[model samples]
Target: MLTNVATVIWDGLNPFEFGAACEAFGLDRSNDGHENIPVPAFAVCSPTPGAVRTSMGFSIEAPHDLGRVAEADLIVIPAMGHTTPETLPDGVAEVLWAGYDRGARLLTLCSGAFALGAAGLLDGHECTTHWMYTDKLQRLHPEAKVIPEVLYVDAGQIVTSAGTAAGLDASLHIWRQEYGAAVAAQIARRMVVPPLRDGGQAQFIDRAVVEPDTETFGSLLEWIVENLHEELDVPTLARRSLMSPRTFARRFRAETGATPHAWITGQRVLRAEQLLERSDRSVEWIAAETGFGNAATLRHHFTRVRGLSPQAYRKRFAC
Candidate 1:
């Protein structure tokens, strides 16, 4: 139901995610497997339409004025490369607040969530931002529940993503909601990122949480990674730690923000990635060593989770 979309441009913007927002909705993709679809028009609206210096020291022009949001369906506030949300230009917050009041969906990429928070739209809502800014975001917006461990958070009308690359994930997710899974998947294929990540952003963080007293979990996580080729299940892991399965499951989720099975799957996928990129291992042997049982199993999960085969990943990363 998006008729028009807009992105707020300002100084020090991260061009990658800002440009990604435009590419996701601005570019005409009708010829790219989307039939009878009118490409959503995108415009860069700023407090003033002129050249603004980016954090990279390069300048780009914003051609439209911020008042254009009145006719827009969605508005994107892109993260600044070297700026904090508190440094937003005067009147920018008022413009964004007006847009939100007019029923426009407020969206942000990475640290862009701060702009939304400043606008008071993220209050009492679940949102996410780049993992590096997780602590800062939570501290800045105490009213908002910052779900730092996820790729993105979709609060119906409002959506936010973590980090720069994760903006693609948020964009595709929006496409999925507006269109369908098939369209989202197709767009992801066109862009060449995983259509969907299997686990949350937590899976990408350091799995071993630091505990003052209980160091068993950290040792167990290390053991699990080293023994990826072995059959290490929850029951077996719990037995090794001398804790009951139920106790282990609860503690693990609290510590890792994911279940035992999900954690293992992520580690296995990561292992496969390492082998693919760093070694000259065949998919069959890689699967066996990465604990996927066989090449077919490896292919199934790798392609499903990563949206790229092991060979393709190697080809891309090995270079």
Candidate 2:
């Protein structure tokens, strides 16, 4: 059903976000002898239908008017380097709502979700934006469930992404739904980016996993990392931290933003990714080493967080 894609451009646009949507759909990949790749009809439209200024102090001509966007099968709103959309065409919100009403898929990259939020499209839906402005987005539209620190959120028809290249991940996710995994993988290979980065990945992985607050629980957290191969249940951790289970759980969530089990699982999966890339060990060995204990358990968690099983990830990413 995704046939035509229309992207809305405006002044103060971030070229990277704008181009992510354009590159995903606009290019005629099938014409390049890639017969399996289906190219959707793509066009760039503007509120004013003329010179659109960019964040880099330059301008690009937008040839089409926004009038046609309401009929598009997919509508894109890229980040404008700000949360609030400014100087949009007349009835832009209405146009978006019309598309939604008719069953068109709407995607917003980074701060572009703000536009949908203004239109009340995000109400009662779990959506996301760039991590830096997630709090502000939540404040502006209190009814929308804004998930922060993840790559993207797919609330059925409405897809929202984090900053920069996360847009490609969201676009590929949509393509994977419309087309097949083979087609999505081919496009990802052509684009020279990793295919199938899951939406739930930590937006800031290293900091979110490795570098927790050092002032409190410094040595305790370090011990957990060192002993990822050992049992890391809450009771064990609570005993080690010298606090009761309930108090430890509350304190852990207060400081780390994730429960102890969730935090420990993320670290183990991170280690599993590294081992899968750098070492030639078997999946069972890696699983045991990362404290998952068995292949099935490791596969379940790894695929949930990474969107690729350990064996598949090794095939694609192993060096």
- By TM-score, the best candidate is 2
Clashing pairs in 2: none
Report how far off residue 26 is in candidate 1 (Å): 1.3
Query: Which window of 10 residues has the lowest lDDT sum in candidate 2?
Result: 197-206
lDDT of candidate 2 over 194-257, digit per residue (tens): 6654224352643543434557777987798899999999999999888999999887876665
Q: Against the hidden reference, what TM-scores do the models get?
A: 0.65, 0.66
Write out the backbone clash pairs for model 1: 12-55, 130-163
CA RMSD of each candidate after superposition = 11.1, 8.2
The RMSD (Cα, Å) of candidate 1 is: 11.1
| Per-residue lDDT of candidate 1, residues 7-111 (tens digit) | 998887887888889777887777876663457778888887899777787988899888887778888888864344568777788878888787888788888
